[model samples]
Target chain A: MIDKQVRTVAEALEGLQDGAAIMISGFGEAGVPAELIDGVVAQGACDLTIISNNAGTGDVGIAALIGAGRVRKVICSYPRMVGSRHFEERYRAGELELELVPQGNLAARIQAAGSGLGAIFTPTGYGTKLAEGKETREIDGRQYVLEYPIQADVALVKAYKADRWGNLVYRKAARNFGPIMAMAGKTTIVQVEDIDPLGTLDPETVVTPGIFVDRIVRIADAGKAAA
Target chain B: MSAADTIQRLDKQQLARRVARDIPEGAYVNLGIGLPTQVANYLDTAGDYFLHSENGILGMGPAPDEDHIDWDLINAGKQPVTLLNGGCFFHHGDSFSMMRGGHIDICVMGAYQVSTRGDLANWHTGDPDAIPAVGGAMDLAIGAKQVFVMMNLLTKTGESKLVEHCTYPLTGLGCVSRIYSELGVIDLGPDGAKVVEMVDNLTLEHLREMTGVDLTMAQ
Candidate 1:
């Protein structure tokens, strides 16, 4: 039952199928799961419905998936890369279906979904074109805003070190969407630098629980030093 | 203490009034993307009321004058924004962790239905026709210590928007503490809904007549 055989991030991501709603964590390259992205690209998984904070600068993070022509739809907030604007151009050209979300809304929607909330409301885009075709209600006598859930089928996350049982801790920006999306998905696969035995991690720092995670792949420093 | 002077019909000037009084010195606030954004327009803050945008901007100031609206510096809504003198850029994730972690002191947001029980249902009405986008309201409602709602008193159909229970999708259950309306200020506290003040010339009965829910006067 124990598979201690470690692999590259790309080797681990090599088996995904089509039409998977994958949630990848990271604000940018800071904590982008290099192996996870490489794996997804190596596998050539297509028709991917990606849910993340951003698509990252092209040639990095989830943008690599976009570059591989593996992503079918992107449910992200911002997709602009610094200088290389072609990925967005490809999206606008209908090569990729882009579903933009307000950054906060995107995070909350993911949290709401993970929490089993039927729905949540806010006035983020009230009285604008964004509020079009939305249900308007009167409460106490004032108008409020509304939105729905954002669930994922597969969540790709990176952690600094994870107990084999899947307790995760992220360093800084790499922690962005991991813990939340870890709870918000059906199958959460974590790629980490070190995999430890149970009871090794401090309870307070273990931000994610073992129950939310399904798979883990360790990226050894020696094996990934050149990468 | 005077009802007529304490609360006014939150017109442009009245909203301007609340914005001036409610925001204290050296506060960090996020003007919730829409009507709550108007708060920035009425600040008497001679120096700072650091604004946080979930889109990763901190130390945000007010909307710039018509001529200075910068394209690169935008708020969460993708609308152009201006930063205060000491503002700087950082990771968006840190901005959100600050939001969800309760580092934020106050948040001024718009509401659809704030229950007498203080439940907030502002995201979606859950109607078949309306498509709601449940955003960070849940995070802000639960994350902020004191949640202040700014809203109009009626729907376009003349129905009250505040209610006993939120019928639409909820942003957060029982998160609202106070509401600043076109009519007056209502506090949703432990005892029930208490009217701290009324819009000038607007009587309790008149307020009741305009609302679908029962109105209990403040002690």
Candidate 2:
């Protein structure tokens, strides 16, 4: 049988090692794979480079991984929020590194990595200090800065549902970066709420095809856990 | 000091209305956090306008009542908001593509300081102790068709925010075109910052003296 389903979070994150670049999909707490993140924490992978939208909030989820001294750097758009004191304190103290990419550029760069593109010219950071060291070109009088792809060794994504074939469906706006991350990562692990039988998921509704997915771990009592 | 000096300047709501007046009809706009977000509430009702929130929301409506609040449906600033009739949600990547692809007509943003030459310095205050959060300000600054800064003319410490040169790290250069402040509204052009309007209570001299930048009164 061709099953992408993994028995536990450990099996889903088997090859994640030290110094690996991990892309986590989320917009705040919306699409984060908590069980996969917890597996990373339990595995104690160090010197990790985390890529996401915002730095994890509070001492849970991403913050817990950072708090445990696992993450050495973070590449994100917004790294500071209400419960992001862990990142703030460490960053201010020079204990952690942060690369702040604009939201658009961040997404485009990740997409470029997945699509086998080298670099993209974006007008987002043109004529700014962020563009200072970057190569820029004027296209018909408008300037565009070159941004390179942001690839990852592993991607941890959360999906609303998945099939035995690993076709994924996302819930509402929580879908955020899950699809893109799945594409950009060398190994993609998905934590899903429900696993439908093979051929049950509609082809049009499948946000992420099983081809991109390496493992699917179903969190027990997903309804209660998500609540 | 005259009693006129005691009169309060434009509050958050008044300043928002002033900024809203300049937005043309049939436009797609993105409003930044804080003061800029307020501008949406005062937009002209007749226009077929669409609001884009970077957190996967497009065609955003006014803030929802407390009873109807949905935490899942929130704006870029993470505040609960209602979706308009035509509103739809998409992935974050698509939301940003709309922002950075020049689809947005205007972006009204809150700034710490804006230079006479339209240089913006809002993401960071240059304070070492402050936690830096760049967010989507950089993309909005350079990608929108026109960038409008909505902020207080002076900082809380009585320092002018409209300066000849910005001291803080810039979000973008030569991006800002118009400025809406409590003291007055100004247009940033090749010549410099020109005072387009002033509160009736304040004089040109008072504005000049406070700003320290040469302010040409619009004819």
User: Which segments of model 1 are wrong by more than 4 Å?
Assistant: A1-45, A53-227, B1-8, B64-72
Q: What DockQ does model 1 achieve?
A: 0.05
Residue-level lDDT of model 1, residues A1-227, one tens digit each, is 54422455554554578988888876545455667777877777788898876675657557667777788888875565453354666665679777767566677778888889988675444443345687766667645557898998878887778886777876533455677788887878888878777777888878788788877888754533221
Per-prediction RMSD in angstroms? 10.8, 2.5
- The digit string of per-residue lDDT tens for model 2 on B12-99 reads 8999999999888778899998879889888888777899888777788888887776656677877778888888777767878887
In order, what DockQ does each candidate have?
0.05, 0.53
Regions of model 2 farther than 4 Å from truth: A220-227, B2-8, B44-48, B65-69
lDDT of 2 by residue, A128-192 (tens): 66677999899999888999999999999998899978799987667888998999999999999
Q: Give the top-scoring candidate (lDDT).
A: 2
Q: What docking grade does candidate 1 earn?
A: incorrect
Best candidate, DockQ: 2
